[model samples]
Target chain A: MKNFDVYVKKQLLEKYPSMVFFLVVMLFPHFGAKAFGLFFIMLFSLASDVRQKRLDLMTFLPLNRRQIFWMEYLFLCLLLSTTFFVGLPFAERSIYAWLVLVRSFIFFSSYFGVIISAVSIGFDPYGAAFLFLLVDLVLGGIGSSQLGPTFNPYKLISPVYQANLLASLVFALILIYMAYRLFTQRGGER
Target chain B: MIRVEHLRKQLGNKQVLSDVSFTVEPGTIFALIGPNGAGKTTTIRCLTGALQADGGQIELFGENYKNFSQIYLKERMAVVPEERHVFRNFTAKDYVQIWSRLYSKWDDTIFSNFVARYSFDLSQKVESYSIGMKTILFVGLCVASQADLLILDEPTQHLDPTVRLEIMDMLKECASSGRTILISSHEIFEIEEYATHFGIIKEGRVIYSDSIDNAKENHRIVDKGENLQASDVIGLVGSSVLVKTKSDVGRYPRLNEIVVGYLTGHHERSLSLR
Candidate 1:
């Protein structure tokens, strides 16, 4: 518990960058489209801490591997959820807006969760994260076409279709479980 | 205080440690001596719980290491890792505060005095400090932790001669106070001066291990003419042959000579096999 407190404190020391993006996305409402991009970048940075040998510093401390893994994953979740709520009031108050927000959260969270797992499993963090981001962009572009409503991942998880939302939720949970399993099983370094 | 048995580890495609086994009695300074790529760092990493052993047993404080909680190991031991990494964003003052919170026995007064004595700027970020300063800061933090055991990997590397002596002296003092110290280092000459016991590792296996005095007493450098058994000869050093004979037949080897003899013997044996 003491180690967790210090670990969180260490993370807060670098909160400036994340805070800056949060404020920009919240105050300057027009930057909403680019907000996801900035948020992903923040997520990439946080996930890459392990790759940067920052985890090596903690390994010397009192924290165990499980605590390190969960603390990090939960911290990212907190950041992502905070960003989502801060931009909520600016929503268009339509089903489409709600679907876009929820689906984007599910998709990106699962995507970055896999990235963190990949890094833990020995993939170079920079290459894996960027490649995943590129894949997300390609999917988003494809989903934004004439068949946008049907194919668009950001529009697919709608409340109208409980099955669709439920499937997405289940898929996200599975991905997260897989990630945690891989991370905790792998050795600290390659 | 620390015991390792048949410690094995594999990193990527290489089997970094094969059978590293040693013990450090409480209050002794045990130096792990080996050449580069000889598994010293891997052994240290495994001991610090940074790298789990693929197959082996490690016991600390008379309990199986696997059975001890992570916090328990950290609470009783302080480590100065070979990487000497720190949270670069933090200042010295921040480190003191954070480490104080993390380690139950952390002594702020000790670290504060160390900072003042070294004239280090407590407000300056660690990233701004030179390599030597960073090493000093890490060593200072380990000392201030006041743990019962200290595991340091090359604590004197990258340091000036004066600072190296000072740090060794500090470690000597720590050992004298009943804290066990385990260090992996290439500074054989310096380690010879202070280490109470040592283990020589080569190619992932501990080839020789014993107390300093016993090592000297057991090995001798003799002329090449005597009918020495192949098993008794340790290594060839120029015209002289190092032998492991208990009889008082030749000049006793110094600590460095014994190390060189064992390593050179291993090199020759490998070359002949090749």
Candidate 2:
């Protein structure tokens, strides 16, 4: 636990600039633009570490792979969620607006989880970004009757209540859990 | 204490570590000497858990590594990876603070003395330090961690000759204080002067491993073309042949002789077979 704390603190200190930038970006009025900005901000923050091989420094410390992965995820969630929550009252008053904000956060987190996991397993972050774009397009469900809204990333942000926020939250948690497993299993190679 | 048996690793299409095996007794400096791409770094990576092995066993302190807790293993070991990387944005003081928080046995006095001896500017960012300074800084950190086991990969790569000798002496002192050291290096002459034991790796395989004294005692350098069994011969040393013999007929081989003989002999034999 001490090691975990130190790791979290180090990460926070190292990426505080990015964190501030993320907070500023979250203040953008449009939900779609905010969600889009959040995705890239989170990806670039984490991907910089992966691409620079900074994770190697943490691996040598007392912390295990699981601790490192979750610590990174924890900071990402805490920082981004805090920014979203703090800015909520000033931006939106209605329960429906709140639901839209929560849904967008959840969907983007789910996508971020997948991309981060791929990056953890040595995939190029730019390549994973391309992968995410493909998933977003498919989830847009453009003229596809077979592909439904159950897992559609577009529904959560569309503001039409096509997808349930609770269901999206659950799906996001599941994807995050899978990402945790994948990182712990294969993340130590470098 | 460390023991590795039949360890294997395949990176991409290359079998980086085909069958590496070695052991280091407590409080001994065991040098892992090998040529470039000979899998020395790969073996070190596997042992440090940075890379997983494809096959075989590794035992640290008599406990199987698979069953051992990595946190526990890390708590007792300090490693200086080959790259000698640092947090580019952090100052020396920041780096020390992080190390102190993470390592339970971190010795501030030791680190302070090192900083003082080297006159390192604590306020300057690590990225601004010269290559040699970065190497020195990590070496200092490894020593100050005060872990029971120290694994350094090319620890003295970027240092001046005088500092290299000083670092080697410091490592010698670390071993004298009952810490086991496993160093993977290409500095044959430097390591020969300080290492108590050695493992020579060639082509992803451990060709020979033994204590310096025992290796010298058991092997001899004879004139080339001496009548010896194929298995008894280790390698060639210029005009002489190195063979495992006990008849008191040939001069004992130096550490470099043994290493060069095995690496070059193996290379020649492989070429002849083709």
Q: Report fnat for all candidates as fractions from 0 to 1.
A: 0.59, 0.43
The 10 consecutive residues of candidate 2 chain B with the worst lDDT sum are: B264-273
How well does each candidate superpose onto the true structure, as a TM-score? 0.85, 0.89
lDDT of 2 by residue, A1-190 (tens): 6776776667666776666666687765446656766676667665667667766677666666667767767666675566667677677577766765676667566766777678777787767776666755566554332356545455553222325566667777877787777766666255
TM-score of chain B in each prediction: 0.92, 0.93
lDDT tens digits by residue: candidate 1, B1-274: 8899999988888999988889999999999999999999888877777777888899889888872245687678877878767775788888888778877888878888888878999899988898889889988988999988988889989899988888899899999999999999988888888899999898898878899999998888887776564438888777888898887777888888888888888543553356
Chain A vs. native, model 2, TM-score: 0.76
Task: Write the residue-wise lDDT of candidate 2 on B25-114 in tens digits.
Answer: 999999999999999988987787766788989998877887224678878888888887776568888888888877789999999999
**Against the true structure, whose lDDT is highest?**
2
What DockQ does each candidate score versus the true complex, computed on alpha carbons? 0.53, 0.51
Q: Which ten residues in a row are the worst by lDDT in model 2 chain A?
A: A153-162
Candidate 2 residue pairs in clash (backbone atoms < 3 Å): none
* Model 2 CAPRI rating: medium
